[model samples]
Target: MGTKSAFNWVTLWASLLFVVILGFSRLSYGMFLPGIQRVLGGSYGQLGILGTVNFIGYLVGTLCLSPLISRFTDRKQVINRMTCLLLGLTLIGSALSDDFTQLGLWRFIIGLLSAIATVLVLSIAMDAVRPAERGVASGLIWLGGSAGILVTGLFAPFTIDPLHLQGWRYAWVTMGVFGVIAAIGFDFATRKRGVVTIPSQTESKLRDRESENVYRLLLNPKRFLFLITSYFFFGAGYIVYFTFLIPYLVSKGTPSLYTGLIWSGIGFAGLFNGWIGGKAIDRWPSGYTLALGLTLGTIGVFGITTNNLLFTVLGASLIGLVSFITPPLMTTALLRRDIPDHLYAVCLSIATAFFASGQIIGPIIGGIVVERHGLQFGVASSAIFMAIAALLAGLYGLQQRKLEVRDLPISS
Candidate 1:
C-alpha cells in the first residue's frame, strides 16, 4: 500500500481504541451526575462547581503529561502502563467514595487520566501519519469518542438506581474495570515485536532537536497567535455545548429515558461526523471546514434558545454533528501548522489544558447564567462563544492566505 493508505489504517485502529476509552471515561460523567446529586443534595450551583473540579483535574493532566511524553522518544509502553494504572485508580475511587467531597476528588483524577490517555493516542496517530491524512486520522480518532458516549449512555440508565444502591458508583467502577481489562489485553497483544514506527536516526535526531526549538518558536508571539486565540475560544464555546446539551434538553420536557437516547444520538452522529469532517479537511482547507462546523453550531445553539421541542431536538443533532467535526479539523490544523512532531504531544497537551481551563470555567459560567437569567439564555450563550471562535477562525484563514502571499516573493 502507499504511505497514505497505510497510515489511514493505522489512524483508524488507534482512533477506535481512543474513542472507546474516552467515551467510557468522559461521557460517563453525565450518567452518574444525577445519582451523585441525589446523595449530595446541592443546588445546581454546587453541582456546577463540582463539575468544574473534575475539569480542573483534566486540564492539569493534559497540560502536565502532554509535554512530559516528549522526554521519552518511545512512550507506547508508558502509555500502556499509565492507562491501566489510571483505570485501576478510577475503580478504587468509585468504590470508596463516602461523600460528594471525596467523590469529586476521585473524579478529578479520573478526568486527568482520561485526558492523558486520549491525547496520547491522538499524538501517536499524528506522529505516525502523513500530513495529508491528518484530517481523516483525526476523524477516525473521534469516532472512538462517539462510541465512548454511546457506551456510557447505554449503561448508565440500566446500571444505576440512586435509591437502590450506589448505582453511580457501580457505573464508574464498571467502566474503570473494563478499561483496565482492555489496557491489559492491549499490552499483551502488542508485546510481541516492533509495532511502533520510529523515524530514521537522522530524522529522529532532527525531530528531537526541533521539539525543543518549538518551545522557543511558539514564543514568537505572532506566528501561531491567531490559532492560539481561536483555540481558547473554541474550547470555551465547544465545551458548553458538550457538557450541557442533554441536561438542557431534559429541562425542556424531554423525558429522562429520551435524554439518554439523545445523548446516544450525539455520539452516534459524532462517529460519522469525525470521518466526514476529516475527509472534508483533506479535500479542502481546514479553515473552511472548521468554519462550516462552527457556523452550524451557532445556528443550532440559536435554535435551541427558541425552546421549540422539534427545533430543540433538531438543533441538538446539528450541534452534535458540528461538535464532532471540530476535533479532527482543529487538531489536524495544529499538527500541519508550524509545530514540530516531537513536541506535538506537549503542545497539543498544553492546548488541551487551555481547553480544560475553558471546561473548568464554562460550567461555572453556565451556572451563574442559569441562575441569573435562565437556562435558555444560558444555553443560548454558547452561540456567542462559538460565533467568536468562528469569526477568529475565519481571520486565521485570511492570515494564512496573507502569509502565503508574503512568501511569494512579491512576484504575483
Candidate 2:
C-alpha cells in the first residue's frame, strides 16, 4: 500500500481504539451516574468519589507507562493489545458489580487500562502520519471519542430505565463487547504495518543525544511548563462540565429525552472538531491554538450556567465543537514538534499524569461546590478554571514567539 493509504488505514483503526477506550470506557461513566446511584444508593459526593478514584488510577497508570515501555520497548504492540483486552474485561466486571464498592473497583481498573491504551493508541496514530499531518491525525484519533459520546448518548436513554434501575448494567456489557471487537480489529489492522520509524543513522544519533537530556530539554522551556499547566487546568475544567451536565439538567426538571438530545448535540458538534481544531493547530501557533480553545470552553461553560435551555444547548454545542478534545490535541501536537520521536511516548506520559492529577481534583472540588452552593455554581467553577488555563496558554504563546525571534538567523 502507498504511504497515504497506509496512514489512513492505520489511523482509522486507531481512532476506533480511542472510541472504545476513551469514549466507552471512560466518558460514558458520567452519563450513567444517575442510574448507578439509583441502583446502588449513593449521594452525589460518594459517586463523585468514584470519578476521583478512577483518575487516581489513571494517574498511576500514566506514571507506570514510561517505565513499562522502557523495559519492554520491542513489545509495545503487545502491551497495547494486552491493555485493550484487560480494559474490555474490566468493563464486563463493572457490569456485574452489585454495589458501590464493587463498581468503584472496576472503574479504577478501567481508568488504569484506559489511560495506557489511550496514550499508546495516540502515539501510534501520530506516528502513522507525516509531520505536517500530525495535527489532523491527532484530531481524527480524538474524534473517535466524539463518536463514542454520540453512541452513548443515543444508547443511554434506551438502556437506562427509571422503573428497572438495572438497565444501566446492560449498557456496560454492550460497551465491553464493543471494546473487545475494537481490540481485535486494531490488532489485525496493525499487525503487518506498524508505526513508521526513522532509520537514518544521523537521526538516530540525534535522537540518542536528545533522549539523554530529555528531562533537561523539556524542563528548560518555560513554554513547556505553561503547556502542561494549561493541560492540568484544562483537565480540571472541562471534566466538570461533562460529569455534571446531565445530572444538573436532570435536577432542573429537564426530561431525559431533551437531555439526551443535548448530550447528543454536544457529540454532533464534536464531529467537526477534527477539521476545525486540526486546521487551527496546523496553521496557528500551538500556544495560541490552545488558548483559543480554552477561551471558547470558558465561554461555553459560562453559557451553561445561565441554565436557559437554548443557551445550555448552545453552550454544550460550542464546548464539543472547540474545547472537548482540543487542548490535549494541541498539547500532543506541540510536544511531537518539540520532542524527539523516540521520547514522544515518555513525554506524553508525563503530561498526561499532570492531566490525570487535575481530573482527580476536579470532581472532588466540583462535588463539594455542588453540595454546598448548587450545580450552577459548580458549573461556573469550570469556566473559571478554563479562563486561568487560557491565560497560561496565551503567555506560553508569547514566550514561544520571543524565543523564535531570538533564535532567528540574521541576514548578512
Candidate 3:
C-alpha cells in the first residue's frame, strides 16, 4: 500500500483496537461487578476495594510507562507489545478466579496494561492525522471506546448466563476473546506503516539530561500546578457521574429499559460531541472550549441530583458529550502551549495520573456521601467540584490572554 493508504489503514485498525480496549478491556468490569460479587460472595466493601485496586494500577501504569515509550525505537513495537500484554491480562482476568483476591490481582493487572494501550493508541492516532484534524481524530478514536461500551451493552444480555448469574464467567471470557481479536487487528494494521521512530539509545549524558528535564518540568511548581489543580477537581466530579449513573437511575426507580436508554443516549451524544469538540478545538481557543465543557458538566451533575429523569438524562448526556469533547483538545492545547514534543508523553502521563488519582478519590468520597447523607448529596457534591474546575479554567484563560497580548506587543 502507498504511504497515505497505509496511514489510513493503520488509523482504522488502531481506532478499532482502542474501542475494544476501552469497552471490553476496561469499562466492562463495572457491568460485570455485581455478577462477580454475587458469585464470589463478597461484601460491597470488598467489591469497592477491588475497583480501587484496579484504578491504582491504572494510575501507576500511566505514570510509569510513559518513559518507556520515549526509550523505544518503534511506535508499532510499543503498540503491539502493549496490546498483546493487555490481551493476555484480559484472558487472565477472565479465566483465573478462585476467589476475590485472585480476581482483584487480575483486574489490577488488566488495568495497568490498559493504561499503556490507551496512551499508545492515542499517540498513534494523533500522529497519523493532520495537525488541523488532530482534535477530530482524537475524538473519533475515543468514540471507539464509546462504541465498545455499546457493544458491551448489546452483548451483556446475550453473554450473561442468567443461570450462572453470580459469576458471569462466560461474559468475561468472551470479552477477553474480543480483546485478543482487537490486538491481532491492531498488529496487522500497523505492521506495514511508515511512522515516527524513537531512538532507543540516547547517549548516557543525553539520557541523564532528558531525565532531569522531564522531572524538572513535570514537577515544576510554576508551570502545571494550576492545570493540575483544575484537573483534580474535574476528576472528582466526572467520575461520580460516569461511574454511578446507572445505579443512581436504578435507585431512583427508573426502569432497566430506561437505564439502558440513558446509556445509549450517552453514547449517541458522545458521537456528536466528539465531532464538535474536534472542530471547536481547531476553530477556537481550546482553553475557552474546555471551560465551556466543564461548565456544562457542572450543570449535568446538578440536574441529576434533582430526581427528574428527563433532567437527569439530559444532564448525563451533557456530561458525556462535553467531557469526551475536551480530552483531545485539552491534550492538543497543552502541547501547543509550549510543552515540547519529547516531553509530551511525560506531561500527558502525569496529567492522566492526576486524573486517575482524582478518580480514585472520587468513588470513595462519593460512596461516603451516598451512604451517610444520600444519593442526591453524592451527586450534588460532584457538581461542586466541576464548578471549581470551570472557575480555575476561566482564570487560566485570563492568564493566557495576557501572555498573548504581551507577546504581540513584542512582535509589533
Candidate 4:
C-alpha cells in the first residue's frame, strides 16, 4: 500500500477495535441500562452499584497494564487480541445473565478487559502516526465510541418490548458478535505493523532531552497535577450524565422511542467530534482544548437539568459534539506530545487509572442523588463536576502558557 493508504488502513482497524472495546463494551451500558433494569428488577441504586463495580474493575485493569506490558513486551499484540476477545465473550455472557448478580459479574469482567484493550489499542494506533497527527488520530479512534452509541441508541430502547422482554439480551448478543468480528479484523490489520522509530542521531538526542524534561515536569506535582485532576472530574461527571440519561427521560413521561432518538442524536452529533474537536486540539493548546470541551459539556449537562424536551435534545447534541470524547483525546494528545514514545503506554495507563477512579465514584453518587432529590438534581450534579473540570483544565492551560513563555529564547 501507499503511505497514505497505509495510514488510513491502520486507523480504520484501530478505530474499529475501539468501537468494540470502548464503544460497545464501555459506553453501551448506559443506553441499555433501563432495559436491563426492567428485566432484572433492580432499583436505580443497585444498578448504580453495578456501574461502580465495572469502573473498579477498569481501575484495576489500568493499574495492572504497565506491569503486564513490561512482562510481555514481545507479546503485546497477543495480549490486545485476547483482551478484545474476552471482552466480546463477556458481553455475550451478559446477554445470558438472568439475575442482577450475573449481569454485574459480566460487566465487571467487561470493564477489566476493555480497559486493557483500550490502552493497548490506542498505543498501537498512535504509534502509526507522527506526533503532529496524533491529535486527529486519537479523535478518530474515539469517534468509534460515538458510532457505538448511535448503534446502541437505535435498538436498545426499542428492543425491550418488541422481543418479549428479551430485547436487551438480543442487543448484547448483537454487540458481542460485532465485537468479535472487529477484534478478528483488528488482529489481521495490525499483524504486520509496528511502532515507528526515529532514525536520526540528532533527533534521538533531542528526543532524549525532551523526555527528561517531561519526566521532570511529571515529578513536579504543581505542573502536572491539574491535568490528571481534570481527567478525574471529567470521568466522574460524564458517566453520570450517560448512566442516567435514558431513565431520567423515561421518568419524565417521554416515550421510549423518543428517548432512543434523543440518544441517537447525541451519537450523530458526536460524528463531528473527530474533525471539529481534533482541529481544535491541533490548533490550540491541549489544556485550552480540554477546557473548552468541558465548558461546553457543563452547559450541555445543565441544559438537561431543565427537563424540557427541546432543551434536553439540544443539551444532548451539544454533549455529543464535544464532551464525550474531547477531554480524553486532548489528554492523550498532550501526553503523547511530551512523553517519550517508549513511555507513552505506561503514562497513559496511569492517567486512565485516575479517570477510572472517578468513574467508580460517579455512578454511586449520581444514583443516590437521583434516589433522594430526583433525576434533575442528579444531572445538575454532573454539570457541577464538569464545571470544576473546566476550571482545572483552564488553569492547566494558563500554566502551559507560562512555561512556554519562560522557555522562549531571548533576542539581542
Candidate 5:
C-alpha cells in the first residue's frame, strides 16, 4: 500500500490499541475494583496494593521497552502483547479462588503488557504520520482511550455489580473478546501483502538508541528540564483526580450512576479537547500551551473539591479536555528540536517513568488525605501540584524567548 493508505490504517489500529490497552485494561480496573475486592474477599488495603503493583509493573515495562521492541518485528511485538493481554484477562476472568496473590500476578502482567502495548501502538502511529503533524496525530490516537472510558462509564453499570461475582467475570470476558478482535486488526495492519514495509535493521537501530538518546537530549538541550518538571507534576496531580474522583463523589452523597455519568462526560469532552489541544500546540509555543492547559486542568481539579454536583461536572469536563494534552505537545516540541525517531521512544519512555512515579505516589497521598481530612480536601490538594506545573511551563516559555535571542547571529 501507499503511504496515505498505510498511515490511515495504522492510525486507526493505534487508536483501537489505545482503547484496549489503556481504557479497558488500565482505566477499567478502577471501575471494577469493588467487584474484584468482593470476589477475592480482600480489603481496601489490598486494593491499594494492587494499584501500586500495577504502576510498578508499568515502570518495569518502560524499562524493558527498548529490548522488547528491539528484539521483535512490529507484528511480532504486537502479537506478543495481545497474547499477554488475553492471558491476563483470561486469568482475571476465571479466578474463583479468591487468592490475592493470584490476582496480583495477573494484574501485574496486564499492567506491564498494557504499558508496552500502549507505547508501541503510539509509536507505530507516529511512524506513519509526518513529524510536523505528530501532535495532532497523537491527540487523535489518545482519543481512543477516552472513547473506551466513555463507553465503559456509560455501559459498565449494567455489566459490573459489586455484589455479583459473575458481573466482574463477564466484564473481563467482554474485554477479552474485544482484544481478540483488536489483535486481528493489528495483524492485518502489519501484514506483508501490498504496503511498504521498512526493514528490520532500520527499526532495530532506532530502538537501540532510544535509551541513550533520552539522557543525551535531556542534558544537551537544557530546555527540557522545565518540560520534564511540568510532566512530573502533571503525573502526580492528574492521577490523584482520576483515581479518587468517583469515590469522592460517592462520599459526597452522589450516586454511583451519577458518578459514572460524570466520568463519561469527561471522556466525551476529551474527544474534542484532544483535538483542540493538538491544534493549539501546532500553532502556539508548547510551553505556553502547556501552562494554559495545566491552568485549565487545575481549575477542574479544584471543582472536585467544591462538593457541588454542577461544579464537579464542570471540573470533570475541564480536566477531561486537557488530561492527555501534555503528551502530544511534549512530543511535538521534542520533534521540533531535531530529535531523531529512534530517540523518540526512549525520550517518551523516560517521561513515562516520571509519569508512572507520580501514579504510584498520587493515590497513596490522596488516600491518606481523604482518610484524615475528608474527600474534598484530598481532591483539592492535587490542584496545588498542577499549579506548580503551570509555573514551570510559564518559566519555560520565557526561557525559550531568551534562548532564541541568544541564538541570533550578531551583526559583524
Candidate 6:
C-alpha cells in the first residue's frame, strides 16, 4: 500500500479499537437503557442520575489521565490498551447489576474505563500520525463512536423484548465478550520489540507545563468565554438527545424496533457528518463554521417535536449528523486562534472538560423536563441551548473581525 493508504488502514484499525472501547464501556448503557430501566425498576429521574454519573466518571478520568499517564509515559501505550481490557471486563460485570444503584455503579465504572481509553487513544494515536493528519485521526476516532452507536442501533431492537428483560442482560454479556476479544486482538497486533524512553513521565510533565503556560498566555476573558461557553452548551444540548431520545420514542408507544432504526440512522448520518465537518474545519473560518454547525444542530433539535414517523426519522438523521460535528470545529477554531503546538493538548483538554461538565448536567435537566413536561418537550428544550451556542459563535466571529479591522495600519 502507498503511504496514504497505509495511514488510512492504520487509522481505521485505531477507530475500530475505539469502537470496542466505547461500545462495551459506554454506548451499551444507552442502547440497553429502556429495557434495563424497566427490568431494574429505575425511575426517569434516577436513570437521569445514572447518565450523570457516567459523565462524572468520564470527567474524573479526563482530569486524572494526564497526571496519571504523565507518571508513566513510556508505558502509555500499555496503559491505554490495558484500560480497554479492564473496560471490557467491567462492562461484562455490569450485566449482573441487580438494581438501579448497582446499575449506576456499573455504568460509572464503564464511563471511567472508557474515558481512560479515550484520552489515551486520542493522544497517543494522534502522536503516531502526521501533524496535518491529526484532524483526520480525530474524525476517525469520533467516527468510531458513531460506529458504536450504529452497532447498538442495529442490534438493540433484535435483542430487546417489550415483555422480557433477559435480552438486555444477555446483550451486555455479549458486548463484553466481544470487547475482550477485540482488546486482545489489538494488543497482539501492536506488540512491539523494545521500549521507547522518550514517552516517559518526564516528557509528559514538561508537556503539561507547556500546555499550562500556553493556556495562561492565551487567556482573554471576553473571547475565551464565548468559546468555552459554547462548548459547555454543546455538552449540555447533545446529551439530552442522546440519552433520552430512545426512551422518549418508546414511551410514546413507538415500537422498540423503530427506536433502533432511529438511532441507527443517527449513526449513519454521523459518519458522513464527521468527514464533512472535518473538511469544513480545514477550509472555512473557524467561527463561521461553528456558527453554521450549531445553527444546523438547532434545526435538528427542533425536528424532534412532531409525532410523524417520517419527520422523526428525518429529525434523528439531522441530529446525528451534527451532534459530533460542532465540537471538532470548535477544536479547529481553538488551534487556529494562534495557539502553539505544545499548548494544543492542554487547551483542548480544558475545553473538553467544559463539554463533559455540560454532559454531567444535561441529563439531570433533561430528565427533569421529561419527568415534568413529557419526553418530547424535554428534547425540545435542548434546542434553546444549541441556539445560545450558535449566538456565541456569531459574536466570537464578529469580535475577531473588529479586532482585525482595528489592527490595520494608519495611512500616512
* Displacement of the residue 299 alpha carbon in candidate 4, Å: 0.6
* Residue-by-residue lDDT tens digits, candidate 2, 181-215: 88888777676565644346665565555556555
**Candidate 1 structure quality by residue, lDDT tens digits, 67-87:** 566556566567746765675
1-412 per-residue lDDT for model 3 (tens digits): 2224213766667667766666666566655554565577764445656666777877888877666655553454655556565665565465558797888788677767777776666665555566555666666666676666666655444333344564457666766776677777766666666544454454434544565566555444444555666777787776666555654555576654556667666767766766677667667654567788888888888777667778887887887688744654464445434554455555677777776787678777776776777666766788887888887766656655655521332112
Q: Compared to the true structure, candidate 6 yields what TM-score?
A: 0.87
TM-score of each: 0.86, 0.93, 0.85, 0.91, 0.85, 0.87
Clashes of each: 4, 0, 0, 0, 2, 0
Task: Give the distance in Å from residue 215's predicted Cα in candidate 5 to where it truly belongs.
Answer: 0.9
- In candidate 5 the C-alpha lDDT for residue 200 amounts to 72
Deviation from truth (RMSD, Å), model 4: 4.0
Give the local distance difference test score of model 2: 0.80
Residue by residue across 127-237, what tens digits does model 4's lDDT show?
Answer: 777767777888888888888888878885566443447787888888898888888887777765544333365654554444444434553544667888899999999
Candidate 6 regions off by >4 Å?
1-6, 185-208, 214-219, 222-225, 325-343, 396-412
RMSD of each: 3.8, 3.2, 3.9, 4.0, 4.2, 4.4
Q: On TM-score, who's better, 5 or 6?
A: 6
* Model 5 misplacement above 4 A: 1-7, 41-45, 70-97, 159-165, 192-213, 219-221, 324-337, 404-412
Assess candidate 1 and give its TM-score to the true structure.
Answer: 0.86
Candidate 6 C-alpha lDDT tens digits along 88-168: 787778888898778778878777777777656565455555555555556676677677778888766655556666777
The segments of candidate 4 whose C-alpha lies over 4 angstroms from its true place after superposition are 1-7, 194-219, 405-412
Best-matching candidate per TM-score: 2
Report the C-alpha lDDT of model 5 over 60-102, residue by residue, as the tens digit.
Answer: 8777875665555445345444654563454345343257786
Residue 107 miss distance in model 3 (angstroms) = 2.0
